[model samples]
Target: MLRWLTRSLHRKLTFVLVIATMVPVILLGMVSYHTASTITEEKAKLTGVNTLRQVNAIIETMVLDVENMSVFLIGQQEVQSYLTRERSGASEYLRMIGFLTNLAFSKPYISDIRIIPFNGNAELTNTTILQSTLFQQVDTDPQFWKNNTKWWSPPLTTVTSSGIKQTVSLVRPIRDMNTFKTIGMLSIGIDTAVIAQRLRDAAVDGAVMLVQDAQGRTIAASSTSITPSFVKIVTDKMTNSHETERLNSVGEGEDNQVVITAPVPIVPWDAYLAIPHHTFSAQNRYVLQLTAIAVVLAVVIMACAVGYFVRQVTKPLIRLARHLPAVSLERAYRPLPVESEDEIGTLISSYNLLNENIRQLTEQVKQNEAAKIEADLQALQAQIQPHFLYNTLSSVQWMAWMSSNDQIANMVGALGDFLRFSLNRGMQMCTVQQELEHIRNYLYIQSIRYPDRFTVETYFPDELMGNQMLKLLLQPLVENSIIHGLLKTKADQRGLLTIEAETPEPGWIRLRVCDNGVGMTEMELHALRERLAHYRFDDKAALHAPVGQDTSGCSAQMKPLGGYGLYNVQKRLLLHYGERAQLHVDSKQGAGTVITLYLMSNWTESQLNAS
Candidate 1:
């Protein structure tokens, strides 16, 4: 049974059960203990306060009795007449003495009684001697009698003739009734042991009690179990006027103990109550036993619940895990069937939808790839056929002008070089140096065709000669400018064309082509920008026109040439270089047209060689 309990699901569920059950149990125990402790402390404090109040009431009554007797004695007609007469009748003096003696013996706490005459000459009378002998003091110093009139005087030690030690004295003044002059004084002594006995009888068990004067000196202590250290703590705390209850560690070594200290009400000292830690532990032992039994029962219940829960949760997760390996990248997988309308069922539904979408997307992607390949092939054929025919015609013309036709021979040579460079041997990219050579070849052909009508200027940094570019890009732009802006004009004046290259910043190159010819109107320019912006490349054939056809003399209402080659060039540049390879066109009507191409500078050697 022990082994089964240890190895069962209870072991795994112990943490949950312990946290759930023990947390509240421990919290409730702590709160109960704290609240009980607080109530116990408050009750102890109240008991101490009540005891102190009782003691204070007893002391106040005793003091008031002493005061009343003193007042009564001072008011006695015999004593007053005696003070005025400078000597009292012996019988009346004996009567006053008898009254005081009766007053002293009436209270058990009072130990002595006497009277002293305050003679202006400071002479010791027979009565003063009697009182001094009773008090066991050498003399009642006149200064002690003179300075104190109302405040209680400091305690004096008194030893009786029988050799018993006692604390002597509560004293007050006696004044002449008519003149209100200080004539003498009355005194009384209280037995400190009697006060201690009263406190001991009234105090609760485990209580420390003390009585003190205004200076915080101990007048009496009720329990001998209280150490000097405890007395010092009470005295120091009382002296500092600290009244709050506090837990104090007392004694040293094996005698160490904790106690709660609370101030006594209307008294000059405090009371302390102490209980050992073992006492609290002993009281809580049954609580601990109940907690252990509850924890054991809780563990049993939680184990069964957790076992059911974990089995239910882990089974689906394990099933999902088994299906994970069947999910292939090349082919989509069907999900496991939903067993119920729970978390696992929702997961299964999501998985199935994800797989279905992935499979459909995969089939659509394959179709799109096939169609793209076919379209690329068609585009390539379209590009290749025109160059093939153009090259063939140039070859035929070159053969036709071999020797006798010098001008035609030159034209054929320029055209052959232009065609060879435009085809670029079917290469897609070429170096800036090679592209410049290709442009030079095209310009040579254009110059041959219109010898005195145009002048071409080329400017390039030696540093940009090695940069790579898309093949035939610059040539087309240059051809477009010459054909559309320069060739259509009938002016005998020279058309100036400029080709320039520069690097304005790191990792960037700009190549510009400027021509002094008829520029487009704002409306035509706007139309051109709108077409190029859309990346439409279906109008290439419409842009191409015969070399000598003139549009300069045509009516202003005639539309300009339309084409997709320029649009295609801009789109391909943007695709490769993003926004950085922008094509900027600036033109002024009849002044000039400038086309600029911006591109990154870090083209590879192989790309440059191809270009």
Candidate 2:
């Protein structure tokens, strides 16, 4: 499942869509639930405080009514006559008890009433005998009866003539109306059940309400199963606090409950509300459940929608992927069908065009290969004719020598040597010495053909002898100078041919072929340089291009080169050595023409072969 989730685009898209939709929804749900929970808790605390306050009011009113009854009985004529007489018959005592009972009945929360005389004697009562232990403490402690202020007794469980009751009483000292002398005590027993019932009526759901006395004893509790720890927590909070009402918490986990307490003004008691924390979060719980449902629904819908859309996109890509192998193998591939007029459709069209271009490029490459072979064969055929001519000339030279014709033999010998070096077994490169030797042979034949008409001078260093250069480089240039320049001069004005070679700087060799003969004008020099600029050795046809017909006006036996010799030298130099090889012509009418060839000096044999 993990691998599929990682590898499948469809699965990944679905997962992302689900996450994208659900994350913010879940986050918002949590925030909203927390916010609602906080508000609900605050409202619950306020409600509990208000309810406790109301409980305080009800219990205070009930206690005040009981205390008011004591004041009313103290002023009663029947009770004053009886106390003054200091002795009462059974009828009078019974009558006083009946009046007290009737008064107790008048106040619903009062269970019993009693009148105690200080003379170690009990007077009429509501059928409950006051225990001597309770009075002994009051008698021994004069402070208990010293004041006329009302007081509340501590919580206790005792048997009354009516029933076993858990209660506390409001106690007041009855004094003489004129003398202000203490006579007896007036006591009214208030049942804790009345206060507990009032607390219960004011409580919220899951809330435990209690009425506890000033001494931290529980008068009554709304919940029968109240924990001791919870009671202690409330007691400690009420003990340490000065506020009338506030919110608090007790215990941990399930035992944890929120407590709110308020003082009861009519008595030394406190009204407490302790609600379990989870109970107050009922509304927030409903919100969280609803929010969870909403998030699930949203994620489900988004996942379905995103999955369908992603399938639409990835299906086309998958089909396109199936064609990749054919492109890799360089095989003919069918074009993808255009499904829409979108970027994908445009992509398919571009791919089809690229495939077409590849086909044309392949055909062009094949044609180029075939043309290369044809040029090689033509070059071989070209070499064969020169070979045959050299053999025929050598035979002619032998015959001339046998016939004792020295001039004919010498001229034919030079011709044979020239042709042998020119062919050079179809090699485009030859040593500088070999090339100079070939040029010397050509000059020898030319000197014989036009003796005394031109004089040849040669100067070169031994260092340059070992340098390799393109074959036939110097021959054509010297030939052009003799036939076109030296021969143009008259016999009385004899021409001079100078061939010089030198190293101008490190890594560079320079050669010059100069003729002190009829030179060309500036216009002709410009036209010739322009013609050389257009020259290319690879295209043999460019050599045959007319560079002005030769006008040397020498003997008709002089061969017609069509003025290609000088241009051929320029083309070969530029082609073999690139631009680094410089060819320049210095000339002026009635002066002389100097042709310079600049080449690198340190090129190796392998480098020359590669060139």
Candidate 3:
């Protein structure tokens, strides 16, 4: 009876359709609601932490400004001279007081500026007059000035001419510049309300912010609504931990709140942002409830409609699946009957067309395999061309010697040597030694062609001789310097070319080709760079595009800005070495030009071959 029930496509589909429609509604809705709640809580906590850090940064800036001001005041000639003077005249005392008053007026949030002498004396300040004995207690305190240190005192109340003010002040000991003795003490008072108001402004509706000292005393708080219990938990966690930043939870379950803590920059203090976890979840609860209700209603409404349509659809597919295996290369398929003009019927027509095209596709695959083999053979032939060129040059050298034309024979011999080194076993890469030799031969032939044209100096370490680089890389650059840059200059001018190599950094090699020649203008260099930007090395069409002049013969006279050799070298350096490789051309008109190539020496030959 079970097999019979399942045998009918409609019966099987009705069971499947009911489970598919109801299971996701029941499972996914619950999972989505839980995931969303978790993410919302995390986002809220993250926002609190970021805001706390921002507030810390602002407070740190203000503290640093006060400290810097103290340093500046101690260096002032008037303050230093007045403090060191054993007995100050009335004119001198008035000058020092005037300077202090100007300083207090210029600074924001400053309640007073006072110079407290270490000796028993009296001095006027920005505020009321103070006797030296009043500050003598602070001067004698070892904790306040240990190792000639500067520090911030905790918030305290002081009576000033303005009113009874609560402030935190930065204290610095004034010392004699020549004797280096503790002369006096300087205090700059900053209003605590300024910091309190900043913290309050940083905290919005969802969070409470606090700025507290190292002793866990609250320096400033955003609101009085913050519970003492929450403050104690944060203080305990901060006092026991050395972390610069951290996030923690307070209380349990629904009563829990997330507390984020960060250090105030350059101050021995911490900044805290405490927010209830439910603050983020409260906004998401109604959404989750609505979603759950909608999911339940959707499942109930779709049950009957899904069962009926799935039964209609599965019967045709059931027939189609049973005959698919029989449709193969060695046999024929029983054609699916088109019983209706719906999507199922259209599917059957498409299947028939696919079956008919299988034979043609097999033949096309065979032809593609043949074409790939032919392309590989052509690539081998191309690799062989370099060897063929080497042999031909050697033959021409001996022929010129047989004719006894000394200059012609020397040129051909040099050209042969250049090609032999360039071939370098058809690997397209060679050691630095072989590369330098190749350039020497090319320059030799050029020297014969243009006598006393340019003097070449090569400086490379003996240790880097074995390092490998692209074959014939430097020859083209040198040729460019001689032909384009040096040739344009006056004959009387010294045409100098210097090829040097060194390790710029670990695992990196740099080569420089510098010439004291008529260098390119800014426009020329910009145009050359634009050409390089558009040239795609991997695209065969772009590489073979009409780059000016063949770089094969070293004597080729390429336009300074339009040389294909420089572009070819640039493209190959980027393609083979990846983006870490760099090529730069620096030139100034009438100054000189320097071409720099940066390459990683850690790469191996097999890696280049693979690329």
The lDDT of each candidate is 0.64, 0.75, 0.76
Clashing pairs in 2: none
Could you arrange the candidates by TM-score from highest to lowest? 2, 3, 1
lDDT of 1 at 112: 69
Q: How do all models score by TM-score?
A: 0.37, 0.49, 0.42
Highest TM-score: which candidate?
2
Could you tell which candidate, 1 or 3, scores higher by TM-score? 3
Q: Tell me the tens digit of each residue's lDDT in model 2 across 187-282.
A: 788888887777777778888899877677788888778777778866564443434676777777787888888888856777788888887687
* Highest-lDDT candidate: 3
What tens digits encode model 1's per-residue C-alpha lDDT throughout 71-156?
77778886666556665556766676676656666777776665667553222221223223433342356566567553343345
Query: lDDT (0-100) at residue 391 of candidate 3?
Result: 79
Q: What lDDT, from 0 to 1, does candidate 3 have?
A: 0.76
- Prediction 2 global C-alpha lDDT: 0.75
2 versus 3: better TM-score goes to: 2
Off by over 4 Å in 2: 119-122, 129-139, 238-243, 283-290, 311-611
TM accuracy, model 3: 0.42
Candidate 1 shows a clash count of: 5
